[model samples]
Target: MAVLALDPHIAPPAIVLQVADRERPAAGGGRLLPSGFLSTSGSQIVDAGGRSVRIASIGWNGTDSPPGAVLAGLWQVSYRTVLDAIVAGGFNTVRIPWTDAGLDVPLNGYNDRLGWIHTSLNWDLVADPAPDANGRYRYVTTLQLFEKVVSYAGQIGLKVIFDHHTNEGTEQKNGLWFDLGPGSAGRDGGVKGRVTAETFKQNWVRIARTFAGNPTVIGFDLHNEPNGEKGLITWGGGGPTDIKAMCETVGAAIQSVNRDALIICPGPFFYAPPPAASGMDPGFATPSGNLTAAGTNPVKLPIANKLVYTVHEYPDEVSDIARFDLAQSGAAYVDRMNRGWGYLVRDNIAPVWIGEMGSSLRTQADRDWAATLIGYMSGDYGNQGGPTFGPGQQPISGSWWLIGPSNDPPYGIQTEWGIGNFRSEQRDITDRMLMR
Candidate 1:
């Protein structure tokens, strides 16, 4: 019962009409997921059959670019090949990030941006071309490209989570989720100049409706890293600017369209002092401004048994490895997780996913930190190689930061895209996560 979000500016494809007419898999070759619908049940994501499911996931970060440009182009691979490699690497879930501008704008309007890439890059390398009726242009609209990718993901037995990574096509520096004007500093000017909260809600409503009843399309990651200096990040009671209120508004809207939709709410960013260089208290410092903290008066969304809380962790940005060295012990890292999003899971309030966390593993310290963190997440404290966090409660699940095939790797899992080859760091992290 998935609905198609067709751009009004373009002629409707026959495939879209076919999708709109069917209650089951449409004739466009997209298949239904075997695992069925996923819902949350007491800190665990349960499948339609009521079995607990842990997300062993990887992020595909292509939508960070302008409309119609995907990361697969950068690697000279097709979206299918990229996803095939992900499944081959033992990942069951893929987090695909997208910009609001890319999703909202019509295909015809994005021709110039697509043209620049078409001229700049080797055209033969681009994949998933949505040529015109007569096969004149080989470019695909952003929505069409996404649809193909999600269809392929389902065909390969991989779950997909659509992440709204940025409001604009450029880097996601604007802290606020809504009220972003065109030509705003740090945003690549295109499409609508002003993005209102209502627009954001409408966009998500369209998304939820489009993907509704598609079991493989799991959830909506509301926003990526709600951090900025404009005070857009608040847990509750900050008025309309509050993250909690926004999630409630948007989550309710999505649920209104599809009640089974799982809503992922990311924790707000706050500065934390580096752990003590040397002292009895060598643990990581407590973050000062976390909105997810129990003390912050967190709000409970209207959606029942479908809320998944998330927190992003980076070795340098979120946690200072130099100050809180993993070599010392896992106590500091464990304590830090407990105070942050972990408390939600510990208190049986909600399921918390370490939505994003990774590093280059360039140095021995970086390697140690990664190992220790993975070990801790897998309930193996201090790299003891055994579950020690508790009996039934560990952080519910986690997804690696990225799945790129960068030559000079910082946080990529593979060394080459579409080759299905994984770096040692990727192997170590995935292996540890599977233990849970």
Candidate 2:
């Protein structure tokens, strides 16, 4: 219907660009690109045509988890193959977790690992990785690598949600949306990885601009698992550390550039059931994945129906999952779910996406927790208002924690570092969960 501008200066890798420029469809003269532009409609995320779009995704982690600072499985598997596995696994989207660690590594560029490819797998990732004759390097920068991944995924009919997992390649060394070095948290410092609020927003803006109007790049999971000792990542405090404030600020900035991108703001770790009345307070730490403040102070974005609140539920040994006895559907558990972020869905406030959820499934408790979570989230109990989308809307959507080779139970979707074989045991759970 309407024209959307994908980055005019830069485009997907040459090989995939041909695929993206295929018979794009919308209406009238036809869409310049795929018609995946998304927006919110009363707690539902809908595609350009206004049909509900469920984000059934699988996380392809490692870029932000550290050690490699690149997408995992590339050491042995091509990203295309990985995408094939994801599609076969029945996921419509891929949650690409990344960091700012390499973004400024290049002297004149962002992300030293530009247009990256495994040297063994593709010619693009040359051993030297240095630009040659026409200032064009045989190797791609990491950002370019990311772009190429998105381009190909879109070609094969998959959406992507870029999750800013950590400040650096390592992890969330600090709870805030920043990483600090010995000196300041204000400027760029790779030594200790300085990522201030300002820099965080700046990095996000850069990313948003990079993929501004590409419909394949559906949403932005702003940050992952906001938690800290005292109250470093509390929301609605109206202060800098307030995660709600951060989401609003960053989301506004993103919509400013790409108004169509869905801004996913997850619940920070500070769970507590909200007070029944204004007189009551849910106190500090409870079992729920916290978004208590938002029960009153919702994340207001520059664009309406574009804010989707999210949560990462591990249920066992993660956060206060045990504290609430969530596996058994305890009262405390349901309450926390409501006050935390569930109300957003039930009250028709905003859509809620479980940004992350996984387990080793080693213990009976683990399996139970996972079952309970997906069941509640999937509207198995539509009468209780656990989570239920509107008519023509998809079931409460989410991404399986990962297609992994991780040690933290790894969200194991594949066996050999995510390249060997499918971890069907784990996928059995996901197949039931996401393949609705």
Candidate 3:
């Protein structure tokens, strides 16, 4: 069921980290991502030397959950071991989804937050060597743990993207980025305080400044699946529920601090606009993949080529009459790609990251859907069209939905007793999905 990458006891081989700075020379250890900072060239994400880079990322969820949190498996295994396993498993990048409430957990409070990590396996997390006067300093803040996660990932050659999964450990069902309002259901129902648009942007700015020169910290995924429907989360209208406007606003704010930071924007659930004529059919789009609105009113940021669009494609294996195509491949999903946001790749609009996607390898429908979707992004169109993996037209790249320590039926990347482990089958699909 679950496959262990290495012994959970031993740490990965210790290697000296040569930080990316003028003070030190560029380090090399066969890093998967390019050495320099990343920028965009039309549709391609290019390194400083202008070589194209494909973002093969895996979304690591759970810290975005309610109450205080830590990166999932740290309680069962060492953070070092789990992170090393990510690289060993053949992934180049990792996306850490976090909530504001989790970020506010203080150092001393982490004693309770880290759960079982208080054991000797991850001593550094609970208490680090400290100044003699203070006996021992406890580096126990969730924020500190988050920074350590970023630092070690970079040291070991994996780039990171921190996603604002939710504001206060509560899902944004209301579709408003600013205030979920009173009786918002979770995170103590604004007992800590409500999340205003300005405060949200400022929170991101603080995170950006925290990792200012860290090359390993690549980008900020502004929001996770602003999956609100038409009446709720519209794009570009500049209304209260305008996610497009919010992305640009928050993105530009983060850039004011970390200018080189890549601003990733995810739109609302589906773009079903009112019929141009009285009786026309409503349009459909993947979750957070509302590029129909973006096509006409593209997100304009302060910096050039710094904007990237992200979408989640949690497609059902079988077609639903409710949503057309659904990556079922019968109607030439590539044709849909050409007509939809996926067209951004062929047209070289901006880089599109499939931010989240996955399925159980059990059923044939699931298998076919996974293959077709990954193939589409990798430029294979599954006999629908020719592959377009080249400079300027680099195939679309993205993070798989998640990796968890559970069987999770249709979507888990890990199998039974999955801590310090992963599913070999999922790993195989991930290998194929990664951009070469």
- Cα lDDT computed for each candidate against the true fold: 0.59, 0.64, 0.64
Candidate 1 C-alpha lDDT tens digits along 27-57 = 1122223477777776666677766667767
TM-score of each: 0.75, 0.79, 0.81
Cα deviation at 286, candidate 1, in Å, is: 6.6
Q: Write the per-residue lDDT of candidate 2 for residues 144-254, one digit (tens) a residue.
A: 777878887777677788988777665464556776532235432343656677787888899899998788898899988776343455556566766777789999998
- Candidate 3 colliding pairs: 107-141
- lDDT of model 3 at position 144: 75
Which number leads on TM-score?
Answer: 3
lDDT of 3 by residue, 272-367 (tens): 442332111135444435666676678888996788888776546312413543455444556655555676666677888877877666777667
Query: What TM-score does model 3 achieve against the real structure?
Result: 0.81
Consecutive 10-residue window with the lowest summed lDDT within model 1: 274-283
> Between prediction 1 and prediction 3, which has the larger lDDT?
3
Query: Candidate 3 at 71: error in angstroms?
Result: 1.0
- lDDT ranking, high to low: 2, 3, 1
Strongest candidate by lDDT: 2
Task: Report lDDT (Cα) of residue 229, candidate 1.
Answer: 37
